[model samples]
Target: MLSYGFWNNKGGTGKTSLCFQSICFYAHQHPEERILVIDVCPQANLSELLLGGLANGGSDRLLARQGAVPRATIGGYFQQRLPSPYQPPAIEPLDYITTPCEYNDEIPENVDLICGDPLLELQANAISTLANNNIPGTDSWIAIIDWIKDLLQPLSGKYDVAFIDCNPSFSIYTQIALSTVDRMVLPVMADDSSRRAIQNAFSLVYGLKLPSDIYATYAFATRLRNANRTLPKVHMIVKNRLTQYMGKASAYAAVLRSIDRDIEKLMDSNPEIFTFEALNDGIVDVRDFQTTGVVAFAKGTPLYSLKTGKRDVMGQRVTVHEDYKANCVEHMNDLVGQL
Candidate 1:
């Protein structure tokens, strides 16, 4: 399966929102293809949003409440096997897979979820310990990293695409998630904090010790100037939560220019590591659909599926404007096209 991770060290960048929209659009575009969404965030916001709500509990609660046979979460897999580092057990992706649509017709059937759990926070430390451990005649840190990768190996031919929504931090879980993905989708806002978040993400990738085999391939690449190696190709740098209004056109343009300059400076500083050009056409700007997004999330429906009508919002009846719905669809299509 082709895996893509939507990540940013900084939160509130609409990372999860973009991931949700992208996967939904992908599934809608290719109904025959199986798509898996693994939520590796401790907050489980993506899990809750995609699965409808926390009340519509899935494998995470199934495993926790009933003490199910096989642990049914990404964190649970590591929590169960990290203790036996010398001989880690195998984990099947299907065992943890939860068909949210099967339970609720409102959801897309082609999309499956590996629900996230708050327990992942606890497992993060254990995974780090195992990764740093140097036990004689035992498994190496690379083995531990591979163990996490193995969890998703069974999904190779089963799904067409896998979208991973990671935590907004550089933890062992994030590292494992990053290692497995073929492409990284960075969602950043047009602001200073977002710029710093991008820098931090690049720094994190530079510091990480990827598999020796992978590292060997980039050893001779001239683009990577420093001792720190590069990372997987950044598929796109998305500018999320953009506000497009004629009233503030100049102001917004200035912000975009600022963001552009920040990206240029970043590439200049780390030429070898960030050789991927940040072209004007390459960076997608997803306009802010404030209330539209809220309605979509609340209804657990794709923005494209939303119709022009009145909908109840927290006991308040509100009209869903046709123009707003069209804008959302336009943006979604644009994002999918860019991808």
Candidate 2:
């Protein structure tokens, strides 16, 4: 299966959110393929999203007695608790049927989720210690990959994609997770700290001796701002006049999120990019822009052609403008093609 990890050193960069939407995107586009969602983060946001809360005991309680459940996680595969009678057999969605979740949505039909318990943080370190002490030929990283191969053994030819949601910081656990994956996608915000995170991400990629042609890497720039602001009319006129003499470079801008004190509207309709300013000002069109989430866009055919505006996929009208829809479609198309 093709593995993808949504990662950034910085937190609250929309890593988990992106992963959830991507799964929805693929499931809507290609419904036949099975998918595996592995939550490698101690926060377990991915797991929580997919599996909901734990049963009886909390997820941590279940993790404390990992051996009790043979098909609980990657660790169980190594211990040979999987449903497969033989070693390294293909993975089956039925393996995770015991996991608890309340998603009646159609997107999860082909998905089989492996929930992450809070105890994963401790389990990772314990495995590291054992590997360093008793394992002669293998390191912890290698062991992680071995576990992945076996855990997914039942799904050998069953899935087209595997999405791993990694924690923000690079831990020994992440080192193992990164070394095993074939491709990685970096989600970056258009700010200074995000740039440094990109640099650190490149360092990690460089350290891994992966094949060149296997999977292409790329950066998706989010949350931008226009540069030409707060200038006087005469200064702005002069700036415009000087533009002819200077070549136009790719102007970078960001949608000011509410989290920033400088940004007045975190979820506003204003086009953060400088280029979008002149086309339409004082009005924000949701269809033409790419906001926090785009999958909620309405899906329908032209009937009597009532312009109720953009609606959620359920065919009910919502307030999303036209610009946001266009940008999201274009961006997602490019991403899927690259994949």
Candidate number achieving the greatest TM-score relative to the actual structure = 1
In angstroms, the error of model 2 at 315 is: 23
- Cα lDDT over the full model 1: 0.72
Residue lDDT tens for model 2, 1-339: 877776777776667655655665565567688777776676765554444223212344335324345446544433342232223454443544323323323235667666554555666666555444444543333444345555565667877888777778766556545544555655655445655565565444442222442322311110000211121010000000011123234232322121122222311333231222332221121112232143231111111111235444334335555654455554454444444
Which regions of candidate 2 deviate over 4 angstroms? 51-102, 106-108, 134-141, 208-330
| Candidate lDDT values, in order | 0.72, 0.45
TM-score to native of every candidate shown: 0.84, 0.56
Residue 147, model 2: lDDT of 51
Q: List ranges where model 1 is wrong by over 4 Å.
A: 54-69, 136-139, 207-230, 246-252, 265-278
